[model samples]
Target chain A: MEKRVTVLAGDGIGKEVTDAAVVVLEAVAKKYGHMFRFDHQLVGGAAVDAKNNPLPEETVASCEASDAILLGAVGGPKWDHNPPALRAEQGLLRLRKQFDLFANLRPVKAVSTLIQSSPLKEDIAKDVDMMIVRELTGGVYFGTPSLYNDEEAVDTMPYSRPEIERIVDKAFEIAMKRNKRITSVDKANVLATSRLWRQIVDEKKAQYPEVEVRHQLVDSVAMSIITSPKDFDVILTENMFGDILSDEASVITGSLGLLPSASIRSDGFGMYEPVHGTAPEIAGQNIANPAAAILSAAMMLTYSFDMLEEAQAIEDAVYGTFEDGYFTGDLTKDQPLGTKEWTEKVLQRLQA
Target chain B: MEKRVTVLAGDGIGKEVTDAAVVVLEAVAKKYGHMFRFDHQLVGGAAVDAKNNPLPEETVASCEASDAILLGAVGGPKWDHNPPALRAEQGLLRLRKQFDLFANLRPVKAVSTLIQSSPLKEDIAKDVDMMIVRELTGGVYFGTPSLYNDEEAVDTMPYSRPEIERIVDKAFEIAMKRNKRITSVDKANVLATSRLWRQIVDEKKAQYPEVEVRHQLVDSVAMSIITSPKDFDVILTENMFGDILSDEASVITGSLGLLPSASIRSDGFGMYEPVHGTAPEIAGQNIANPAAAILSAAMMLTYSFDMLEEAQAIEDAVYGTFEDGYFTGDLTKDQPLGTKEWTEKVLQRLQA
Candidate 1:
């Protein structure tokens, strides 16, 4: 297999974690007889410092030319005071829009040893393993006539049949790959968009009769997610609800640092990244966890490159490391391993 | 003090629980030397059965003429197949719109004895006592140009400066009345409505200089609420965000049956109700917990009637019952007291 990857190691600890991720990715490539060309690019504060643009044109060109993108993290206090247009965070948003990434996949799984660290009781947190499929680039966030002034403001939440069908179909596809159950979440009782969304979901269900479907009101599901997280297989929701529920699900695992996310277009092109932000305070400390970033690389391999076995190998290595009681500081109150040490352990496990 | 109270004991457990609430209310009136006139009215499935209207014109008129209203619950299996207009839940919406009830106040407190019942660990769920103030009758749920068909759909989330200000002011006032810290939730980075909402919250903070205010993006706050629930004093957000967060907060307490809510107009006219729905399965059974409904009557005393001492009496009595190891079935796995017996216990504690 041959793949070209764009690595946007944005700023602060992003550099450290992405470095760790690349090392693991190279190790995987060596273990699997594959060729991967790494294209290092400037983004966020680094890009602004170099070319006065948060998302340099050259970087986008490189990404467009690549098979997939692996982003470390973006933004820091260095560009916090910058105007909205020039802000480092805007670079990432522009990149997503530029690629037309429409579906965001967040997989949350409770680690067996880390269940004690969860805010939820062991009985509740231990059994939670679910994926949240969020519709990106549509609905209220991007709806037209979103006007705001000193007097009034408006944000439209619009969705067409095609938009709903694609996301619903994506969810069904993903669910078929995993647990074969889909919990389509919406505010059907209130929002017009939700009513149409439910209609589309029902239509999609008829096509994929093997995949069981359940429609839940957003409010009820929000509570249900917490009350009975293990009950869910694949949670499908619109943009705003997804933004809220994905973040909510992130905390459920008790290990936000280990979570990986993928944003992909209708085709195979995708961007993978760790769910956490740049920890400037911990930059250069070598203690930040690189598991999420590494797992993101694994996601890109499976989701973009069709390397399922290779991806599962990385996942197993990461899980096996935790099983052996090797963890980063975030996972435990006891002494923890540095980024290099953790990566080495995972690499050693991958070889075995 | 003399006041007219409209009691809408809608259907199923609504009748049982409201009966329990009225008994507590009459007891409070006897103890506090207040004159109270009760006007009972039909609503929900019962109203649909009698007058063939979910919210009858006479019921609306009675509610309009009263100083405040105490509602039990609404909706049941009997009216599940009715048309949208005649549906049992529509009656509640009509009443809220009729009263122009814009500010929704839901106070969530994790009971000390029932902390073990929560899905959250004791450390996380024990200290949770926060109030969520939601801006109802606005935002995407009621926004105009909300159209839907098989092809496409749209729901606008429009907010005027006045709409934001009133809700912000209401939150600040409520914060001043309780702990003087407010966490205003919005999605300012992406949503235009949130940006305007943040602007209004900032401007309102200038008026209540003593009330410390913090702006949180809705997604981050949703996670933080579960992670550090004790940190919140007052959680104020727009309609949909509030609907989700308030329900999320409700389950954090572990005893949803013990929570109460208020929907108020600017001038203190409000309707009080238990946060739990009418439990049709347990409707005629004497096992329903009346703690939430009784506490709702307490909210009416303080918020609508301005009888703080009387309200405190009801709250303290309920807490006292729990402290004495008196458990409702919803609160514990042990043998539990019936609704009437629990009401008698609360009344006994009030007189003591």
Candidate 2:
């Protein structure tokens, strides 16, 4: 199998982490007897510096032609002074719009070695392993009539049947592949969008009869996420709720820097990236952790390329690195390793 | 000073808990040399049964004529089959709108003795004592054009300058009285209403120069509530964000049954209630905890009546009840006492 991945090493630690991911992907390709190609494209702050635009037309074209996209991180204080339209983060939002990436998958697992690092009690936080599937394209963030007239402001949170259907179907499909329970979260007791969402989910339940489904109010889900995180297998929500909940879930794990996320359209195309932001402070330090970016590549292998064995191998190597007493500064209870050293340890485990 | 409080013991454990609150309030009045009057009224399912209305006109009139309102839990399974207009919870919503209660205060404190009750580790959850001030009347929930046309549904989250100013001022005023910091939560990066919200908060900051203000996106606050709850002093947010966050804050304490909340209008008129809902399953069991209801009375004394010493006395006695090896059925790590027995213990501590 051959895959072309557009690598957008945007700014700061973005370049360092993307480089680490590429190295890990090369090892996976060699070990699994596969052909892989990489296209380096400028985006975010790097693009603004080179092309005077956060997202160049050429970069978007390259990503469009690639089988998958791997983004490291984007934006920093240097670009913070820029106008909102020209800000580096706007480029990523535009990219999502270009691809119409409607579904965002964030898998938050409490890492065994770092369980003690979690803010939640060990008994409450330890067994949490769930996938949060969020509807990205439609919702309050992009809905019509969203503006302020100096005195008052209005933003619409709207959802159509088709939008709800596609996201709900994705959640069910993913739930069937893993655990059989899907928790559909919304404010059905109040919001019309949530009522429509619940209606569509109910209609789709007929098809996946074997899968168990439960509907939770958004407020209740927020509370439950902290109290009974172990009860969740797959959490399906709209854009804003997901934005809040996925981040909440990450914080509870106490391993925010090591989490990866994937945003994909209806088709198999996806752009994977670490959940962390560009750390301008650590850009050239060579001490940034690369595990999240590497794990994101693993997600791409499983989700986009259907290379389950290769994905599992990479995941095993990541778990092995931590178990073998290797740690990045962020995850260390003892000795800390640099990006290159951590990548080397993961690579050795992958080959074994 | 003399005060009249309209007491609406709505449904299920409402009667049991409100009865306990009255006993506690009476004890406080006698000890503190104040005259207190209680006016009983029917509401929720009980009102529905007797008057064919969830919130009878008589109930509203009684609340309007009183200096303040103290309500127990509302709604139960008995009213589950009722039409939307006749639902038990509507009574509470109608009352809030009737009084134009715009500011909601939910104080979530991690009880030191019940530190083990929280889902978060003792180190993270031990010192959490934050007040969440929510804008209740305005936002997406009640904003105009909140409807569905089968294909698409929309709810507008609109905020006027006055709404923002009032809530921000309330938060700052409360912050000045407690800790000197306020964290205003919004989605300014994404939502237009939030941008306006930030603008108003900034304008109001000049008046309360003594209070340090910080801005955080709602998503970040959700995560931080779980990761670093002890860092928060006051959290100010709009309706929907507050609805979600207050519940999330409640769960982290693992004492949802023991938390009290207050919804206040501009002119010092307010309604105090337990954060817990009526448990129909345990309605007549006498096993429900009365701590939250008793604490709600404490809030009424401090917030509406301005009887600080009386409020402190009630608060201390409640805490003393917990500290002196008396445990209610719900909060018991060892011995469990019934509601009546727990109320007697609290009363005994109050008189001591």
The digit string of per-residue lDDT tens for model 1 on B1-352 reads: 8999999999878888888888888988999899889999999888999999999999999998999999999998889999888899988999999999999999998888888888888999896889999999898898889999889999989999888888898899889888899999999988899999999899888899999999999999989878999999999999999999988888986888889999998899999999889998988889899999999999999889989899999999998899899977776678799988888999999888
Candidate 2 local lDDT, A1-352, one digit each (tens): 9999999999889999989999999999999999889999999988888988999999999998999999999998888999887789988999999998899999998878888888988888887889999999989999889999779999989888899889999899888877879999999887888888988899999999988999999999998888889999999999999999998888887888999999987777999999999998888788999999999999999888989899999999998888787898877747799999899999999988
TM-score of every candidate relative to the true structure: 0.98, 0.98
RMSD of 1: 1.4
Model 2, runs deviating above 4 Å = none
Best-fitting candidate, scored by DockQ: 1
Lowest lDDT 10-residue stretch of candidate 1 chain B: B327-336
lDDT of 2 by residue, B10-114 (tens): 999999999999999999889888888999999999999999898999989999889999999889888888998798988998899889999999999877788
Please list the residue runs of candidate 1 whose C-alpha ends up more than 4 Å from where it truly belongs after superposition: none
In the range A1-352, model 1's lDDT, one tens digit per residue, is 8899999999888888889889888988999999899999999888999998999999999999999999989999989999888899988999999998898999999888788888888899896889999999898888898888899999999999888888888898889878899999999988899999998899888889899999998888889878999999999999999999999989986988889999987787999999999998998899999999999998898788888888999999998899999998877667799999989999999999
The number of clashing residue pairs in model 1 is 0
